[model samples]
Target chain A: MRLLIEIEVRFGEFVLSVNESLTLDGVTALFGPSGSGKTTLLRCIAGLEPRAEGRIEADDQAWLDSKAGVSLPAHHRMAGMVFQQALLFPHLSVRKNLLYGWRRRGQRPGPDFSEVLDALRLAPLLEQRENELSGGEMQRVALGRVLLSAPRMLLLDEPLAAQDERRKAEILPYLKRTIREFQLPVVYVSHAVDEVMPMASRVLHMDSGRLQSSAAARVSGGTAFGAILLGATLQRQLDSRLAVFCVGNAEVIAFLDSDTPNAREVLLAVEPRDLVIATGKTDAPLNAGAMDCTVRSIGEDETSGNLVLELAAGSSSFRLEHSFARHSDTVLRVGQKIRVLLTQPARVASPIVQSGTGRDSA
Target chain B: MIRAVEVIELDSLWLTLRLASLSTAILMVLATPLAYWLATTKAGIKPIVEAVTALPLILPPTVLGFYLLILFSPSSAFGSLWVQVTGQTLSFSFTGILLASVVHSFPFAVQPMQTAFENNGRRPAEVAQSLGASPFDAFITVTVPMARRGFLTAAVLGFAHSVGEFGVILLVGGNIPGRTRVISIDIYTHVETLDYASAHFLSMLTLCFAMLVLSLVFIVNRRYPIRT
Candidate 1:
């Protein structure tokens, strides 16, 4: 499914204008700074912003059409939203809040009642009141409540922003698992790069209330210039400092400098500058992962005057940026074969289960 | 053991209770929508509507009574319409006093409810809608339950204010024993006739009742510790 949107809203001097058709394949991250209309865009999609005008079509259903004067009310939009604050029904118990939307689904098919509880681990907290749950637990329950509503699409506005590091660590895995299991088209709004890297299969960057660009997240994650190796399972630990991961079709050896022994699976993020381009295979050090790649295309960074090369490795593709002077002697073509080295140690993210640490840090 | 004069005094007290009960019931029904509108509307005339609702809070009861009396006179449009409907003028009647009490107690019924809605915010209602609840369903299921304390406070204050009304009732519904004579007016009658003994008894009773009502409010407020 895909979403076709052309919306414009004006709040005094500030105007938010967006025109894009997003392919709702996986998690699509709306990435931007705090005041850059990321949340506004998400709100517009959910039919929460009444003043927003323009056409929004999800598949063939028209959610909003200004010229036709058809603006579906929020309840009829069939878009479930999870806000930054859990905003659970304080008067209701955890079980009631979870069942609230499920009971209101009105003949629509939804997730099984018991399965949602199991997925979000909400069975234990069912009898508890809203105030009794912790931040992470509350957010999980909020997500579960929205999921039970059986919406066509999910709109999340910084669902984890209110949590501290430890709470975030506690909730991220459940979020990842829920999205994977539900397989619903999700528009995830967040300003943090670390968050988008781990969750987003595509990123739409926004700035100053205008959409900047939309980039595909090949098989794994990240935008045009960054790479996130998702679902990289641990092959084996060679020593205290060395480990191997099976990323896609290649066995990549990674350097582990921290205690991540309990990380059964990890997400590895590599920035644009960390990838090194070499015309011929170089004798790389033990700490880096080197692979054969074919240069798909090359372009210049307009702002920094650096050459950015789009490369394909096995079934995955990524971009590598380098200063123009560094590669002045070599001529590069669109389909030239080359070798790329992951020089820096990719930042290792939280494990699916953190075991016992980082839970009560706050 | 009961004297005839005490029986007459009891009748006035009974009249006061009936008036207070009816006024409180009507105000609650009217205030729900008015308070909700005041809390959520962004219209330019919101301040004007708010000021009108709160006029009774600041204006002296006698001034409000004077205007109400004029409006209820036989020559006025509303008074003439009332006369045509019920074959009597609005002034000097129980219905007239009831209307005056509702107007006098308007702020007491609305302010607490409006504050509650504002503190509860639009987020909860919007969240409810996103969860598949219609607007009215969200209001009844989520908004009302969340702001219950405000409703309780408004009811108690409105009831109390109507029970304590004196000047407005005196002007709009002229003192005619058993008809317009409420407890406050009855107490005034006792004092005017140099009947200090009867006046003291009724005054003490009202004082104790007021204290009990206020204490109930304070205790409930302490237990719940309202959401700021």
Candidate 2:
């Protein structure tokens, strides 16, 4: 689905004018500082702010058309939003809160009721009240509540921003799993780069009420130039400091400097600026994962004055950007074998695809 | 002493109850929408509307009564229209006193409700709307439940104020024996006739009823205190 939005609103000293057309599929993270119109943009999309004059179209549905004088109110917009707080009704029990939105779906087909309960791991907390649940638990229930409503596009406005580190760690994986399973266009606002890197396939960077940059976080097919997400598995967990992952059969010994996912299946993110490339395999340090790959393409970034090298290791291809002088090392070629060392472990992300129900394997 | 004037007391008591009940019910219905608008709308004329609604509170009862008397006289347009429609003059009638009481107790009904709506704010309604409730549905389901204390206070205050009304009712309805002789007017008549026994009894009754209404408001408010 695609969304075209152009809206302007003024509040005392600040005037917010944002105009952008976005492809609203694949989890897209909206990153910005506070008071940067991230929440306002979501509010406009949800029709919570009616006075905003703009045109918004989601797929074929025109949510707002100013010339035709069409502005749907919040109730008619059919967006299932999970707020930063108030994930569920405070006055209701967990069961009642779920049922409230579940019954409102009317005749639309959505994720099955049992599937949401199992997927969000909310069965144990079904009888509990919202206050009884922890922050992470409430966010999970919030996701379940939204799924029950069968939204066309999910809008989560900083869902995990209020939680502590442990709670955030507990809740983010469920969001990642939800995105993977539903594959709906999920637009969420977040401030942390670590959270954005693992989950969002696309990132829209905003500043001063405008989209500064937009890119595909994955390889080849998006707008911004963020870290590329790769699908790899934890092939071996030999010791505390070392874990081996088969990124297509070249056993990559990734240093586990911190907490790593216990699940054998994990996603690894390698940033282009973090990798070191040499024309030949060298005496690499103990803490870094070194790779032997044949270079596929080389180009210089006009803005950064860095040589952008695209290399292929086994079946996966990745890019690296490094500053270059006129004469530094041996000349690089298109098909030359080179060793790449990553001093920092590629951050371990949640498993890309998990069982869609009853996830006992956390 | 009580048995000697029991019949008059009963008649006056019944009339007062009927007038207060009718006035309170109609006032609540009419004031709810006005209070909601006043609480929520950012319209420029809100202060003007509030000033008009509050006029009855500060204006002397005699001044209000004098104007209402003129307004209900058959020589005036509204009085003549009422006479033409009902085949009776509006002044010196039961309906006249009822209308006068509604005007007198307008603020009592509206102020508390307006305060409740403003205190309740727009968040609950907005949340309900996102959960698939229309505007009116949200008002009834979320707004009303959260503002129940305000409703209770407004209703009790309106009912009690109408029950104790004397000056405005006397001016509009003229203290007819079985028609407009409410408890306060009956007490006034007893005092004028030097019948201290009946005056004391009816005065005590009004005091007790007022106490009951005030106590009910306080208890309800205490039971369900607004939590943030």
Report chain B TM per candidate. Answer: 0.94, 0.95
DockQ-derived CAPRI band for the predicted complex in model 1: acceptable
Interface RMSD of each: 1.7, 2.5
**Which candidate tops TM-score?**
1
Each model's TM-score for chain A is 0.64, 0.62
Q: What digit string (tens of lDDT, one per residue) describes model 1 on residues A237-290?
A: 778877777665565666674755455566566765666676554866678776
What digit string (tens of lDDT, one per residue) describes model 1 on residues B1-228? 359888878888899889999999999999999999999998899999999999999999999999999999989998898899999878999999999999999999999999999989999999999999999999999999898899988999899898889999999998989889999999998899998888898889889988998899889778765432
B111-194: candidate 2 lDDT, tens digit per residue: 999998998887767766676667887788778876787888888889989998989988888889889899999999999999
Fnat scores for every prediction: 0.77, 0.35
Among all windows of 10 consecutive residues in model 2 chain B, the one with the lowest summed lDDT is B219-228
In every candidate, how many clashes are there? 0, 5
**lDDT value, residue B119 of candidate 2:** 84
Summing lDDT over every window of 10 consecutive residues in candidate 2 chain A, give the lowest-scoring window: A215-224
Q: After superposition, how far is residue A225 of candidate 2 from its true place, in Å?
A: 20
